[model samples]
Structure formats: C-alpha cells, structure tokens
Target: MKATPADQQELLRLQSIDTRLQQLAHKLGALPQTAPLAELAQRETAVRGTRAEAIGALEDARSELTRLESDVAVVEARIARDTDRLQHTSSVKDVQALEAELASLAKRRSDLEDQELVVMERVEDAEVVVSSIDLQRAAIESEVAELEAERDAAAGGIGVEREQTERDREVVAAGVPAELLAFYEQRRARGAGVGAALLRQRTCGGCTMTLTGSDLEQVRRSAPDDVVQCPECDRILVRTDESGL
Candidate 1:
C-alpha cells in the first residue's frame, strides 16, 4: 500500500493518541480507591451482621428484664394484701398465720427484686454493645461514602480526558487515507495496540529488533511512498532521517 510520507507520520500521532486513551481507560478502571471501596463493602456486610446479633441480644435482655419486673410487681401486691390482713386480724392463731405468710411473701419479693436487678444490668450491657456496634457501622459507612466520592471524582476526570483524546484521534484519523487507516486498525487489533512505529537507528520500534542484511536492503530499495512493514512485528515502519539507513 502507498501513502505519502506525511500521511505515514500522522499514523504515529494517531498511535500516540490511542495509547493515551488506553492509559486513560486503564486509569479509570484501576483507581486507587476502588480496591479499598470493595474491601470496605465487605467489612460493612460483616459489621451489619454483628450489629444484627447485638440487637437481638439487646431485645432478649429487655424481654427478660420485663418478665422479672412483672414477677416483682406480683410479689409486692401479695405482700401488701397479707400485711393488711395481719393488721386487722382478731384471733392470735389467725394473727400468727398472717404474720408467717407475710414473712414468706417478703422473702419471695426480695428474691424477685434481686433477679430483676441482675437482669437490668444485663439489659444495660446489651444496650451498650448495640450502641458500640452502631458507632462502628456508622464509621464504616462514612468511610465508604468518602471513598466513593473519591472514586467518582477520579473516574470523572479520566472520562473527560478520554473524551478529549478520542476527539483528537478522530481528527488525526480523518486525515489518514481510509485504506491505510483500515490496515492500521487491522494490525492493531491482531497484534499489540500499536499498529505503526518509527524505524529509528535501523531498529523496528514496535518490536525493538534491529534490521540488517537483506531486510535493511529491502527497506532502502523500497519507494519513499511504498508502505514498509517490520519483519519482526509486522507493523507499518515509518521511516525518517533517524532510520539509520
């Protein structure tokens, strides 16, 4: 294929633009905050699980405390009724029985009260555990929000750069011969992202292999407008004064 020397050089500019676009795409995908954000997501899931368990424990403790309070209330009511009867009793035998019953009720009430206190302490501890877990979850959420904001900002910048680079590519590519550009695109797809390279110092810039003997002679014999390819990498070889012929 024949392309003017000037058009051939434009291929290098196109390649540079394409390479920059590729770098920008890679940067977008590999933002520094991406991995940490994923890790924080996993951490948040685990933390939520822990928080759910803590909440369950707190609910259980509160339920137990309620039962204990109810038992204490019932015992106090019985004690009050027994004390009233003891105060109004006429017979000595009746008075003794009432006093004995009142004493039993008092002991029962004391035991229930003790148990209620213990359960109240457990409820308080459970609540503290839930509250601490809440704080931890909130911290994780905050960090996640910050990381997401950073990731979005980084991606937005890359997107803008990519759009500009693509526009530059379009303008550069429009100047290239359609047949030559198509061939270049095909080579780029089949091989590395680079489709053309400078032949500097007798070396194939695409593969970095020095041309010698017949290969060097062949390139020298070719017309200036004749497209030449590197024997090593099959990429279009763009020659200039630095080609070291």
Candidate 2:
C-alpha cells in the first residue's frame, strides 16, 4: 500500500514470520503421536491379540472334545464284545470274568461321557469368547477406518495451507528489492530470523540489545532512506517511532 522501501522491507519480514508461525501452528496441531490414527492402531492391535487367544482356546476345546468322544466309542465297543462273550461262555468262571469285564467297560464309558460333557461345555464357552472378541475386533476396525479418514483430511488441509504459504512467499518476494532480497535470503539461510528487525527504544529488536551512545547518535543522524543493520545481529534494522533513542 505505497509503503516506503524500509517499510516494505519490514512488511516482508513480518509476512515471512507470519508464514512460519502458521506452519509451526499447523505442525503442533497435527502431531503424529497424538493423532487419532495412532490411538486407533493401538486399540486394533490389542483386539487382534485377544481374538487370536480366543481362537486358540476354541481350537483346543474342540480337540479335547474329539479325543473324549473317541474314548467313549472304544469303551462302548469293549462292553459289546464282553456281553457277546458272556452269552456264549460255558464255565461259571468265564461268565464271571466276562461280567466283570463288561462292568469295567461300562464304568469307563460313563467316565468318558462325563469328560465329553465337560469338554462340550468348555467348547461352548470358548465359542462365546471367540464371538465376543470378533465383535470387538469389528468395532476396532470401524474406528481405524474413521481415524484414517480423519488423518487423510488433516493431510489434505495441510497441503492447502502449504500452497497458500507458497503464494504469500511469492508476493512478499516480489515487493522486496532484488539486492536486498538476496542479502536477506543469505542471512536467513545463515539462521537469522527473517533477516530483518524493528528498532525500538534504541534497542536492536534482532538481538534485543541497546546500541552504544555513539552508534545510537549515528543511527539517528542517518537519512531515513538509508538502510542500517544492527551491529550485534547483522540484521537489517527498520527505525520505528517507538525507538526512544
């Protein structure tokens, strides 16, 4: 807006600071560790572990139930064979032995049936656990999807802001004189903040140090159009009305 060369340079410096501040603010707002996606990933991992344990338990229960059922079948077969032998036996001793064998097989069959029942109950419980874990895993998957969407949105928004900053930088660059722009860029690359500072109350804003009496006098006597640099920080110093010295 028709600013003097010094005022324009100051504006450019201010713009540069504002741009960096905008980027820093965005970065602070969008930290990866604190993002929703990260938390969702952690929850998904826990749910998956639980699901795996539940599945393993179910498989073990099924295996035990199978073994118990096989044992029951074997005992029943032995009881049948002993009953046939008892029917055909001629001696009282042989008959007694067959009866005893049949009784033992019956007891074994009963025991195997009880074990089978217990295994069946455990299988049912494992199935319930697996079902519960599956539901939980599904829920976590939905949350992960939502978090990924949010992360994508945040990234898209940051991209837009970066483009806007680039445009603003171009505008600021155009207003700055070529030689001055080169000088500012060089100093900025060397770690100076914007390569310019405002002089206020006889203090160099770049370094926040007050100038010596003679240097202060010299600055005051210099033409307004002349560009001056802070001795301590080597930054282009713009004189402001608030400079007391």
Candidate 3:
C-alpha cells in the first residue's frame, strides 16, 4: 500500500521503537543475575569447591590413619625385641634392666595402638563425609543440567522473536524517507528510544506536557502531511484523528 512521506516516517519511528523494545527484552533476558544459566553456573562452582574440600579432608584422614598404623607397627616391633631380650638375659642385673625396658615398651605400644584406633575411626567418618558430598555434588550437577536445558529453550524462543522483530523493522524501514529516518535516529539516540509520540488532547506525549493555546492553534493549522516535532522534547509528533482536543 502507498504511504505518505509522513506516514512512512511514523512507521519508521514505530519500527525503531519496536527494535529497541526487542533489544531491551533480550538484554533483560540475558542478564547474569536474572538468567537461570548464570545462577546454575554459580551454584556449580560452589559445589565443585565443596567437593574439592571434602576430597582433601578425606585424603588427609586416610594419610593420618596410615601414619598411625605404621607407628603402631614400629612400637609392636620394639615390644617384641624387648621381650626377647628379657627372656635371653642370664645375669640378675641384666634381667632386671631388660624387665624395666620391656615395661616401658609395652606402655608405648599401648599408647600407639590407642592413637591408631582413633585415627581409624576418624577415617571412617571422613569416608562417610566424602560419600555424602559426592551424592550432593551429583544432585547439583543434575539440577545444573536441567537449568541449562531450560535456559537454552528460553533463549531459543527469544531468538525467534528477535528475528521476527528485525524482519518487521526492515519492512517498516523501507517505507521511510532517508532524511526523516536519520532525523528520527538522531532524536532517538538523544532521548533514549523515545524520539516520537502521538500528539493528543493538545498535549505532547513525548514530554507529557500540554501545548499552549497559541502553539496548539499553530499545530492545528500546520499541513497534515508535514512532519512536526515537539519544541520541548524534540520528538516527532504525529497528529491523529483520535486526538481528543
């Protein structure tokens, strides 16, 4: 359909507004704080850190247990050697000295065994903690996967909408005069996506301010096909049949 230069300009302005609106929607959708994928990623990072700490603790516990066992073995060997010495020594003085050494070795062995038992218990507790953490990590991974899938689906939908909006913009852009389009773009850049609005009831929608009686009269007398800009907002004002005043 044939469109007047004024109509074409208005259409272009509408297209620009729609394009900006679509971009705003995309920007909002992709925000790190708002996007499900980003939140999932943060959670994944935390889970990984927790798992690392759990693994470290488990390893430390195992190492402590191993060390304690080795110490117990050394103490037991000392006890065995002292017992053999006590049995073989013939002189009364030598036997008495050997008995004293054996007694000390026995006490040391007992202490080492007790410590080893404590370490073994700690190892068991650590293993349980590791197992529980593994399960928690697995559950978090599953949730992350679900969130990624959801995010992908949502982004796909937004992509389709973006493509449609771009197509619509192209169609609308083809109708506008290049000079008018340039003017609107400049105004839009200055005013943050609000470069044009319908003038209604003697008010400029761009500024939300009513026009003076003289200005209203002047605007009314202006040619219908002419492009008019709001003096206050510098936004192109479209006069409409539905303007109440």
- TM-score for all predictions? 0.55, 0.53, 0.52
Per TM-score, the best of the predicted structures is 1
The sequence of per-residue lDDT tens digits that candidate 3 reaches over residues 38-155 is 6667777887888788788879988987887787788788878878877887889988887888788788878878887887888888888878877877887787777666666656
lDDT of 3: 0.73
Q: Give the per-residue lDDT digits (tens) of candidate 2, residues 18-104.
A: 548567566846766346667777887888888898889999999999988888888888888888888888999999888888888
lDDT of 1 by residue, 104-181 (tens): 888888888888889889889998998898898899899999988988887997888888889999999999999999
Candidate 2 overall lDDT versus native? 0.74
Task: State the TM-score for model 3.
Answer: 0.52
Question: Which candidate has the top score in lDDT?
Answer: 1
Taking all chains together, the TM-score of candidate 1 against the true structure is 0.55
